[model samples]
Target: MLCKIPDIAKGVISLFASGRLSTEDYREIMQPQIESYRKSTGKTYIYVEADVLLEGWQHQSLAGSGQVQLPNFDALVLVGGPDWFGNAVRLMGPFMQGEVAWYPLEQKALAIQWIAARTDSCN
Candidate 1:
């Protein structure tokens, strides 16, 4: 499951994730943000805090379904699980089209700082 975090700055969004990921999670919760950015000619800054990876076939589909709006992103900061989760992020980077980064679950401040730095480079 996924949900958008409210009250953050424009062009930047925070999302919390738990349980198995799915295409529906993106379609329902994330696609709207991409559409909104496209209409406004703004780059997307997506920060996701995930509690778990997508399970079963959902994990495989992420490689395909995940990149539908590939160019819509400018920076992606993901915070979750172990330090190796960052490795998982890099492993999955080819399936994405932005700066894909991961931070330990407790280093949210660092994650936010990294995303803020990339905001200046957004197109």
Candidate 2:
């Protein structure tokens, strides 16, 4: 499942991914949000919560496609397991040129706050 974080007031767009993620899920949920963020902020900062179930070749292929579809963002906050963090870093390396920070799921608030602050300063 994927969800947008509530209570974030800045231009930074946040998402939480849990359980299994599918290509259809990305098209339905993430794509529209990314489009909206681009239209509003010109740049986006994404915060992704771990607990993601990255299973199946189709799911992985969809994730790769989604990465290509994303707009240039100022930063990315990855909150999850170390393995997930490492995979995300490798996958997103090419698309990201700005700051990328990782923290455990326990530090979700800190991650959000950091991304918000970074986005603010960048703007």
Candidate 3:
């Protein structure tokens, strides 16, 4: 299940995923709040805690035909997850419009702080 991590700084959306994350979870649970915030606020900063995924996004059948609109982030901070996943995200950093950062699960606090600091730059 994906649960929102509360108490995060304003302008930043944080989510914690602990089990299988289905497209339904993203579209039904995650998307609405994200789109709502994006529509209200011009920029978006996202933080995700992905240390405990029973099945990750790569295992999902999400592809071309029914692609959904994703929020354009100002900063994307990912904490925890497999090493390869972290590496892939880091490698894709340059190709992404927003900044991408990865941190170990243990450094979650630092990752949140980093994202919060990034949000401060826009203000």
Candidate 4:
């Protein structure tokens, strides 16, 4: 399950991944959001909550490669369980050059606020 964070004014794209995440799910759920962000701001600042069970080598490989093709962004916020959070950071680190922030699930709201503020300052 993925959702955009509410109340942030910038073109920030957020997603929450829960349970098993397949490649098809990634494409179906995330691709549209990425496209929407691109159309809105010509870039995307993606925040991902890592509460998912990642499966299949192919899915992981595709995710790793596909991230490189993502539109430019201002930042990425990763929030979730510690292990998954670490994994998410490791997987997505290379593709990210802008500010990157991470927080535990308990701190998601704060993370969003920080990201929003940071986005505002950058623009």
Indicate which candidate wins on lDDT.
3
Candidate 4, 48-115: lDDT as tens digits: 77664633224463565663244456677777744755676767777687777778778878988978
For each candidate, the alpha-carbon lDDT, in order, equals 0.70, 0.69, 0.77, 0.66
- Model 3: ten consecutive residues of lowest lDDT: 52-61
lDDT agreement of model 3 with the native: 0.77
Residues 6-91, model 2: lDDT tens digits: 63547766777766666665677777887898888788778877674643225464555553244556787777754655576767
Q: How well is each residue in 1-123 modelled by candidate 3, as lDDT tens digits?
A: 677878477888878876677677788767876787688887788888886453564344356645444557788888887676678778888989889998988998899899999889886
Best model per TM-score: 3
**Cα RMSD (Å) per model?**
3.4, 3.4, 2.1, 3.7
Question: Residue 71: error of model 1 in Å?
Answer: 5.1
Error of 1 at 23 (Å): 2.2
Q: Candidate 4: which stretches are off by over 4 Å?
A: 1-10, 52-71, 82-84, 87-95
Better of 1 and 3 by TM-score: 3
Query: 3-115, model 1: which lDDT tens digit per residue?
Result: 78761344677777776656676777788876776578557788877764533225554575454333547778888754556787889887887777888878878887888
Report residue 39 deviation for candidate 3 (angstroms): 2.6
Candidate 4, residue 114: lDDT: 74
TM-score of each: 0.74, 0.73, 0.84, 0.68
TM-score, candidate 3, is 0.84
- Residue 90, model 1: lDDT of 80
Off by over 4 Å in 3: 58-61
